[model samples]
Target: MIEPSYYLSNIVQELKPSGIRKFFDLAAGMEGVISLGVGEPDFVTPWNVREACILSLEQGYTSYTANAGLIELRKEISHYLKNLTNIEYNPHNQVLVTVGGSQALDISLRAIVNPGDEVIVIEPSFVSYASLVTLAGGIPVPVQTTGDMEFKLQPEELEKAITEKTKAIILCSPNNPTGTCLNKKELEMIAEIIEKYDLLVISDEIYAELTYDEAYTSFVSIKGMEERTILVSGFSKGFAMTGWRLGYIAANPEFLNAMLKIHQYSMMCAPTMAQYAAIEAMKNGKEDVIHMKKSYRQRRNLFVGALNDIGLTCHVPGGAFYAFPSIQKTNLTSEEFAEQLLMEEKVAVVPGNVFGKSGEGFVRCSYASSLEQLQEAVRRMQRFVESRT
Candidate 1:
């Protein structure tokens, strides 16, 4: 008999399981639990897009697509990105379809990072960034961001975090947990740093389509940035196609080719039917996205106003369907507040500390649920906050 630990990779073992998943698991079986935990969209996958997948299957699209995904899908993505972000790509070599945006991000890190290289991660960010950087054999250097800045990464902070070993920076605009988006001006300032340092930028724009307050800016679209940027997006949030498991990355051919090498060996290709569905989404799903974004905006306003009225002091999220409110006033740690809310009030939200140390004393509440559900959750949370005060 032997211990598996003897042969296991320490990094994988040392990795903390996602706190978001842990909270979701705890609340999953609880009856009457109103979840503001997961950031999944409540919208059904658009009927038209789903129908496209069905038709593709009927037409014998069950076989694997090209390793880079369907040619037409890639071309459509090139057009979609060019029109929206004004960043043009050849499609033939610049687009690589992935299982989800996660794969695009993971493989990009694998492609670019060498052992012991440093990847600057801005927090509180999506959880995967740090772990993936580590998995890719790079050091994850976390830079703190405060809620006072709406959780936007400051250029000065980024500059201070960089060292000679720094190879890249991960930027998630319309950031997760916080739901705040970076504007063009802010991105330009970041671009100046990137250019000055000659660092690569991995811009995760998964929530780009859901921006509520202003025009979304593509980090790669910043002047002189395309050469050094890898843009990752997917059909999940905006298209409500999470189960479809479709995402794509666009970048310079050199980087994309390197990513494709890793993707081809590991994933081969994205699901064939999903590729077809995503093609339809790119071609005709704009109106559906617009409809969903409008719904999210209404829910955002409702939830934020309700939380503020109850003294939660939630940031007015500019994009994404999350409301990050400081729970500091209640004198409860984020985990305690979220856990008590679930136990006593049956409202489940993720503790902000799971996102990063800076996220302590706050909680991330997803507004992706219905207006009715959001209203009910807010009511329960209001009661919880009041008792604490």
Candidate 2:
């Protein structure tokens, strides 16, 4: 048996397996698991969006599109961003579609990061950031945020993490695991810091359409931040199109070109049918997004309040569908809390520590499930807490 190359890349060796996946794996094989662990929306893709994709299939649009994705889709994305976020970009050269926001980040990191370069990441962020940074041969500098601050990163934290080697800061607002959003003033402060230091920024606005209290702010909307920021977004969250595998990146031509080259080699193009569908999504998906956002907000309130009543001490997340609640009161580590809840109560929530060290003593509960599920989860959690008490 040819031992598969004894020397795997150090980048691969240094990475820790996903903390979320371990629980998911166990939950997957078990029966009667009610999971709030996954971050995906519970809704199906909008009917019209699905129809658009079917139309593309009927038209024989299965071949690979241009490396930068369909020109038509880029134009739609450009128009969509302009209408919603006031961010402008040329569809011709400023955008490159990818597998999802996840791959877009991977491509962007590969294009920009050199070996030993430092990439500042806020925690607890989505799981892919550090992995992508490692794959791109960059060092991931994790800056931990706290529940007290609603999990928002402070300007001072960013300042403390920066050094001569710093290449970029990854911003994920309406953040994963925590559901924290950075307000315009907060984002402006970060933009100021980045501009002052002349560092690049990768703004992952994948959950841009999911905000509750205020409108989503695009970094590109901030003056001078556009040139320095690479915006990453997709149809998954907004249009409930996760399985479509469609997302795009917008940046200046130089950065776009670099990502296009990597994308050309790695993915060749995003799914042609998905691109066609995305065009429809961009043009007509606003109503779909609004409907979903309204539902999410209702769920958010219900779940947050319910968790609080159950003695979880959850923050009222401003955006995204997750509720990050402390497990500390029960005197359980995040893993222990989540595991016992699953084993005894049949409730599957992700341990916050899976996202980062900062996520310790909390668990992330996604409220994208139905109201019935949310009600049941809260009842079970109440029982679990009472038992612990």
Candidate 3:
């Protein structure tokens, strides 16, 4: 018999399991563990959105949607993007609904990446970017950002990473893990580099609505980027609709159509009921998102302040629900610090090294839990830190 390993594709066989899931799975079996490892919203899906899904089912709308997605949901997504970025997207050709933002990212990479193409992935970013690039037969060239740089990718660093074989860049803002949101000027500078290099951008803006300090800027909204940016977003973060498994991609028609082809063959369509819910979410979900964002902001202030007070030295994240605190002072690696903290204090966090090499001295803790849970987690973390000191 052939070895099991022989049956697996070389790429899939070599791919590492998600680092975020390692701690999450460990904490799952333990009692009384406060898990900040997963980047999920603690808020329940808004009642109105749920109701919309319920109504759709009750009205017998249970069949598969158009391969691209429900026309109505696509229209809503178009309207939402237009309002947010002042850029018009034709719902008919510019938007393709996906199973989730994850699938959108996957298919976007699949649609564009050719074998041996180099894709620049900014680190420490969401865990999937590099893996997806690899699975798509592309080389993931990591460009690490430093805490001193506030975790924002610098133009010079991006320029240095580019080579003749470089095909695209995957950018997440309000970034995951670090929660750094790039301002317009910062993005424009990067955009300049992209234009000069003539590279495509897979811009993950799932956390756009969660940005606290300033209005979110869409990459496609950047001058000359409309044709080059694959804008990926979903209802999962801001609308607390993760389980709904619905997301969308907006790009130039050429790119959109290419992604739609892959999505149609691979996913068929996003859940029909979820599409209904997303329609309502895009139409009437602003208030719910605003409320959630406000709550997250309060939690961010509390959690980040407590992290700093406990000497973990975290920069206040501008968006997303994570606090990435440097654990260098503990004289332990990120994994060691996180593992010991979980064993000693029942607090779960993802080691930053899993995100990328530059993430080695930090750990990511989600502040999306209740304020009470966050406070207790912080106290436990403080105790753990003191014990180490």
lDDT of 2 by residue, 273-367 (tens): 98999999888888988899999999999889988887889888888889999989888899999999999998999999988899999999999
lDDT of each: 0.92, 0.90, 0.93
Measured with C-alpha atoms, the lDDT of residue 269 in candidate 3 is 85
Ranking of all predicted structures according to lDDT, beginning with the best and ending with the worst: 3, 1, 2
Q: After the best TM-score superposition of candidate 2, give how far the Cα of residue 183 lies from its true spot, in angstroms.
A: 0.9
**Steric overlap count per candidate:** 0, 0, 0
Model 1 Cα lDDT, one tens digit per residue, 1-389: 99999999999999999989988898988999989998889899988899999999899879888999999999999999999799888889999999999999999999999999999989998989999999999999999999788788889999999999999999998989899899999999999999999999999999999998899999988999999999999999988999999999999999999999999899999999999999999999999999999999999999999999999997899999999999999999998998888999999999999988899988999999988888898888888888999
Screening candidate 2 with a backbone cut-off below 3 angstroms (N, C-alpha, C), the clashing residue pairs are: none
- TM-score: which is higher, 2 or 3? 3
Which whole-number lDDT from 0 to 100 does residue 288 have in model 2? 83
Candidate 2: minimum summed lDDT over ten consecutive residues — where?
Answer: 2-11
Q: RMSD for each model, in Å, please?
A: 0.8, 1.1, 0.8
